[model samples]
Target chain A: MTWVYAVTLLILLISLIVGVWRVIQGPRLADRLLAAQLFGTTGVAVLLLLAELQSLPAARDTALVLALLAMLAAVAFVSRVWKVRPDSEDRP
Target chain B: MNLLIDFTLLIGILAIALTCLISRSLFRSVVFFILLGLMLAIGWIRLGAPDIALAEAAIGAGITGVLLLDTLGHLKKTGNLENDEPAPGRKRLILAIVSSFTLVGLLLWAVFNQPTPAINIHLLVTEAMPESGVSHPITAVLLNFRSYDTLLEVGVLVLAVLVGLALQTDQQAQDSLPGLPNPLLHACLTLLIPAMLITSMYLLWAGADRPGGAFQAGAMLAAAFILLHISGIKLSSQVSHRMMQAGLLLGFGVFLAVATSSLIGGRPLLTYPEGGAGMLILLIELALTLSIGLILLSLFTIANSPPHHKDQGGDHGH
Candidate 1:
């Protein structure tokens, strides 16, 4: 079971790396923001796996906080940042 | 397997940090920084420090990310987002590299040549735990044993908010970012806000026996407040100005008052009376939680508010 957790965590970390590539390669701000959102969700999964693997319950709380704040960046980007760049709105 | 996990985390953290530092796009840098924070939180957990992990999650990743993104928005509004900042000259790059390498070398040297402690401070904390008024060692250490440090830290937070407040030329300036008028966001808030509030209180309650505490709880509360503010539920406007000011000062005031009371009792300042340490710590934490929340929200709002002249110009133009 611990090994299973380890493998799952490894997979999530790999996915995070993949997500970072999108953020780095983005020709669009929305693409980068979406990749960041992927990180948030993946981060929660990693935290939860760590909690189970290490038998540390507080890691679960960290996951919960991550889950809650996951959408915040998107909200901030849309309402604050993206709204200002009207030109970027029509870009693919 | 554990070694593999640790190795991956190390590489990921280093790579993310380097990217954040070197990324030409400010927005990309901010995103990578947030990702780096997430990675660090996991690193903290791997080191068996869940308290620090929680703090990293709440403040480092959550609050700091929002603040940076908001700053980016401000920069965009001012047409400075794409301004070509001059690349570092060769001399400056060499200086930076040399200084950073020197710091890293010093750190590595210190790590390799650690001196044995004259005292087993962990043992002392364990021995004194029964008298420290809390079951959790971290909380007991933070709010009970080394509470003076916590008091000063709260004072610093309060001071930071005060500086931000002072910098605002107009107290009543409205936030330039209009409320997000999404119905889905509003629907989500109905559920999310309550959960966040409950979690904040639970964190405060858990501190007595677990890893949660005032600072983490306060950050959680601040996140909820900021969410509401972003979604158009302006907490600042809902409450009176006097009331908001009082809320911001409540934690530091209560902490100072308690510390002074201890001094008057000849307990050498900040030393709680016998049998009252637990209650006093709880009281201080409760006040700190509220004040920290208000302080963080104020910082966000102060940054979000438009400049006084801009507001006036827009008003006259309209």
Candidate 2:
């Protein structure tokens, strides 16, 4: 079970790292936002895995928090897009 | 057997991640990212963290996807601004790959090499499990044993909302105006909303017996609200009254109230007095779920609000 959890965590970590690369290399803000969302998803996965590995009870709570935070971040990013340019084509 | 499942899920997650990063269309990337969230949720479940799985499904896949799509709409409006830039050349891509692998290698090493903490949390949980009315060690630890962390976690959420409010200037009311709320959409909401409510309630009430609690319930409620918002049921600022704010703070408020009363009853802060903890936790979860839903919906609605008041008078105000 621990081994399964460890491998899952490892895969998630890789996903996050790749997502981070996308964030840095993003030619546009929208791409970066997408990448950021991936990062948060991976973070939640990591927390869940940790909860299992350590037998910690807060893994779910932490994951929940991460989800909410990710939503907020995504919303904020979207709003910024709306704010910066009213049209769908403005580049920042 | 477990290892096989883990490897398969890992491959699936990797594929999703690759598509999310490499996809050219913004819409496609958004969809893939949501899929990635789903896969990650399954990974959590496979790892034996059902609570985390619930959270990841509701918050990670559901709400985050909505937010991303909304942002994508904005990006489309912005026109191909970023796409104008050249995609990374081969040399840069190769360098990025090398560096990312190195970072991963280092992280893996750290994970494997870190000396285990001296304290045996498992032993502590086992020893203290008898004292907790709750059977699930994680729930007991979260709410009964190390509830301080939980309290602070709630506090962090409140603080984030406050910061969001403060940062948001010229907030326009994103109230749902009379538009064709599609019958299908309404139908889905009717079914899903009630079901979600029941599940949220169950999560809170069952925290003592199973892998559910306030945080899970709260996120679930938030997911329902997200659905409503996307379907055009907006969260109006005019309705964010003192009661609404109180509801938002209900989790922290109820927990504090209970914890303080415990002192007078001769127990420490947050120490549930025997069987009472389960009920108290339920009450907290219920309140938290409602507030969390409202909070999340409000934040997203406000964020998606057009800058000018006239700009948001109706559906997709131009």
Candidate 3:
């Protein structure tokens, strides 16, 4: 069980890394926002797995809190991106 | 056998995460990420944490999805979504790879090295289950024993909304619903809204007896709102009116009211008076589920960006 959890987390971390690449390499702000949202989602999964490792219920609550906060962050980022960038059609 | 299921679920999660990270279209990535959240919710259940599972399904998959879709919409309205030339950065790829390895190494080391504890307080709560009216220890912890945490959590949620409002667009007049409409979409909304309401009520009522609670209930209500949005039914800012606002705080309010009243009786806050305590807890949870759901949905709706065209091809309400 522990091995599976470990491997699963490892794969999730890899995905987050790739997402970080997108965040940096993103040509448009939307892509960066998407990458950040991906990171947040993966963060929630990581927290849940950690909770299992520690056999702690509070960890799950923390994960829940993180998940909610991540969603909030995504919304904030999107709004910010929208405010900063002009519509694509406006560009030459 | 259960471990095998766990392995399979993990694989599914990995696939979704990879897709979410690498999808060509930003809108499609957001949709996939929401699906990924749902898959992760199932993963939580496989790991024997139904409380986490329920909460994830509601907030993680349901409300978060709406917010993402909303952002995608906003991007669409701005016409900023496009596959442009890659930013001048091959160095970023190297940095991402190196940091990813660093992160995984740290996680593996910590998971392996951490000493397992001998006793878990959750078990203690289980043992003392008879003293509390609630059957589920987590619920008991959430609403009774650790009711203070639950109260503060709701406050955190409210604060997040306040902050989100301050940070995001203040377009109170522009409804957050998707623009397009389809007959099938309408059918789904008609079917799902009632189911959401019933399930939310059931979850709140059964919270003391089972795995449901305010968080789960709030998520369900949020899910219903998401369904409404995707179907193009916009909720005005006044969606949750004055009574609705009060009801949204019902869980915390009742808990505080009962807890304070108990002070006169020389009891701690959230202390139940023997047999009648279960009803009080249920009432609070029910009101809270309603209030929390509305507040969360309102937060996402207000924060939601208009949908971009490409997001339409992604998963629909699953």
Candidate 4:
């Protein structure tokens, strides 16, 4: 069980590194933002794994909060980008 | 294996921070900055500090991302974003790299040289936990052992919103993005908002025995309100300024009232009567959750607002 958790966290860490690489070579603003979103998801997974491995329930709570707020950046991105574009329909 | 994980995270965090600093595009850099916050949240969890991790994920990564993205949007609109992001010349880039490495070296040196003989606060916190208002050590510390600090922390949040609102009042009203009128989004909110609210309230109430607390709960609530706003729910307009003001003050007001009432009881300020500390702390936490939520929502809304042309005739809300 401990080894399984370690492997899971290892995979997450590798994925995070890959995501940061994507951010560095962003072809567009959206791509960079997507990498950040990936981080948020991966982070929750990693937190959950650690929570189990360390027997600390607080890490699970942090994961829950992370999962809950994950959409905020994406939502803010869409709203602000569209609003500033000067062409959003008035939700008719 | 643990060491390897820590080393990898360390490298990843450092690389992301450097990338955020030197990324040629301001927008890209801000996105990287948000990513940095996310990575830092993970690091905090690894260090066994879930309270800090929750705050980092919520406020550090989530809210900061919103504010930075909004600022980038404004800069893009004014054409300042592109103009100000001229690529660094080779010499300047090298200088920046050198200086950053030196700073990192200094930090590493300090870490390695730090003495470890200081009293262990973990033990102190644990020793006091049963007597403190909350069973959770961090909660007890924040609201009971060092409650005056918590009171001031809430005050600082209040002051920040007021200052931000003051700076925002006469500013140009930026175009609000139309919350897309889609049944899916509406349906999602119907389910999601309730869950978010329930979780936030549970977090507040469970704080006595768990890792959650008013600040995390408040931040979650604020995120919920922002989510609602983005989904075409016009909560800000429905809530009159007077009402908003009342909501903003509710947390601070309740805290101050509790503190003063204790004073009237002939105890020192903020000292609850015997066996009443738990209930008092819970009450303060409840009001604080509401006020903090409103303050954060207000900041979110104000940041999204457009800069008004100084010559345009606009009515200030203040």
Among these predictions, the greatest TM-score belongs to: 1
Q: Residue pairs in steric clash, candidate 1?
A: none
TM-score of candidate 3's A chain against the true A chain: 0.81
Assess the local accuracy of residue B8 in candidate 3 as a C-alpha lDDT between 0 and 100.
57
Clashes of 4: 2
Where does candidate 1 chain B have its weakest 10-residue lDDT segment? B309-318
- Residues A1-92 of candidate 3: C-alpha lDDT, one tens digit per residue: 87787777768766765675665566776776677677667767866876786465544654554444444434433333353333322221
CAPRI band for model 4: medium
Candidate 2 segments exceeding 4 Å error: A1-92, B1-4, B77-85, B88-99, B175-180, B235-240, B261-268, B307-318
Give the per-residue lDDT of model 2 (tens digit) for B24-139.
Answer: 76655765777677678767766767777777767677677767766655544434235444688999999999999999999999999999889998998999887777788888
lDDT value, residue B172 of candidate 1: 63
Ranking by lDDT: 1, 4, 2, 3
lDDT of each: 0.87, 0.66, 0.64, 0.80
- Candidate 2 chain B, poorest ten consecutive residues by summed lDDT: B173-182
DockQ, per model, reads 0.52, 0.07, 0.05, 0.56
Candidate 3, pairs of clashing residues: A88-B79, B70-B305, B73-B306, B73-B307, B74-B305, B74-B306, B248-B291
Candidate 1 lDDT tens digits, B1-318: 999999999999999999999888898899898898889999999999999999899988888898888888776765557736789999999999999999999999999999999999999999999888889999999987898899899889888888887788765667665567788989999999999999999999999999999999999999999888777689977899889999999999999999899877777987888888899889999999999898988877886555445445332211
Q: How many clashes show up in model 3?
A: 7
Worst 10 residues of 4 chain B by lDDT: B309-318
Candidate 3, residue B213: the lDDT equals 77
Q: Is candidate 2 or candidate 4 better by TM-score?
A: 4
Best-performing candidate as measured by DockQ:
4
